[model samples]
Target: MLGAFVDGELPASARETLEARLADDPRAAARVAAWRAQKAALRALCEGARVSGEDAAPDAGQAGAEPAVLILRPSGSWWWRAGMAAAWVAVGAGLAVAATMLVPRLAPGLAPELMAGAAPTAARSETSEAFARRADIAYAVYSPEQRHPVEVGAADEAHLVAWLSRRLGKPLSVPSLAEYGYTLVGGRLLPGNTGPAAQFMYENDAGERLTLYVASSAVDRDPVRLLRDGNRRTFYWSTERTGYALSGPQTEPKLREIALDVCGALGGKPGQW
Candidate 1:
């Protein structure tokens, strides 16, 4: 191990490990110093033994015996080699960092929309907090109305579904909350953060209401998420290229129960809840 270190034959990590051991062990450090000194002496002896020709006479008292023929490298050459290797590694890391920071800045002509899928930002993926807030706002605006709560009444359920599916660029289905005691009142068109949104409203016997807001989502899939606004709550998730936010005034436990059923009916995974 000591010979490999002196010859610079060990890999960097192994060299570092051995170096640490040497620093803490006086006997090991002594061995390294002795090896270095011995190498220097051998290199000096080899250089001084150099002669003009192979036919030269042997030294005075050593006649008929071979002269010193060992070839030794200078002690400092290994350190020089190690320094060049480290410099090359540093240069490679610098190039990688520069590429990451400069590539996008160099291409100013690329449209933001064209790069949307390549680099999805928060704008493309609206957070659950914003989704829930929008559902709450839509419900607050329309739920109080008696005659115009919806743009299309439930009497034309088929038309409303078809119209919404076309506007959002994806097929949509409304899951009945009737089992949880709310009946569908109707649905309407609304503006979403990124595109057109659809809102389907429902009310129970006591007139308390809920709204399911949906829009085109870049998010392929996500687990169910819940959000709370002062007097309201929302259970939201993204699935099958669409985002759904259900807002109501019910407690979290009650709303959670209703949200799971709604999720199952809309083909969302049961484990997501």
Candidate 2:
């Protein structure tokens, strides 16, 4: 269990089970810590070797300079060659460790716990919190785009809503935030875990933008909640047929007010602030 945890190969439920046991067993916790430390050391060694090799490489501008070369002379004894072979094997092992650590970072949309060398906690299917986190990540990824931020603009709001409604299998509406100094900028269609989702964007005169992410859900009752990730605050809720998340870089109190307005416009009850 400790090895799998360090390698980030454990399933979420099994990892949670191991973590619970570790909390009660100090010795197991210590072992896990040692494993993490060893992995870190191996990664550092591999990085140092790479940096050193890069530093030793000839610069492109030094074209007139002689290129450096390394030549290996075999010793007379068989044991000497065997020892060198073993050293190369050790170096290969170190490189493998570094590559393992880099794989998660290079992969798209990897869980934070996996990249951090920790096990992820299990989540229920179509949970509101999980949906909110996904919405937040999508907002963070797309909100900064200077071009092509949305698939459809507010100039075509009627068509955009109709298209998304057909894809999501639910009636969709765009909330008006004109009272809050925000005008509809545009909207976009996004792929959700269970089905298609829609994102409606609004921008104020100051250029600050906010987004409403809506998708179909099976929950019959409202599961309204507020979540904060980095500088963004999201208020999420679910109805019998749809889930909604409003995310922006605004104060919680202000975002909550906007969330209420959005809920009211959508004809859903907003959670008490």
Best by lDDT: 1
lDDT score, candidate 2, position 248 = 93
Highest-TM-score candidate? 2
Local accuracy of candidate 2 as per-residue lDDT tens digits, 1-273: 689786778988999999999998767899999987876665544443333334654442342333344445565889888998899999999998987788667875564656576543334246778889989988897788776779899999999999999998878889899988999888888989776889998889888889999987767657568988889999988766688999999899888888888987887866443
Query: Model 1, residue 144: displacement in angstroms?
Result: 1.9
The stretch of ten residues in a row with the least summed lDDT in candidate 1 is: 57-66
- Candidates in order, TM-scores: namely 0.56, 0.57
Query: Candidate 1 regions off by >4 Å?
Result: 1-105, 108-124
lDDT of each: 0.81, 0.80
RMSD of every prediction: 25.7, 19.8
Off by over 4 Å in 2: 1-124, 271-273
**Model 1 residue 166 lDDT?**
96
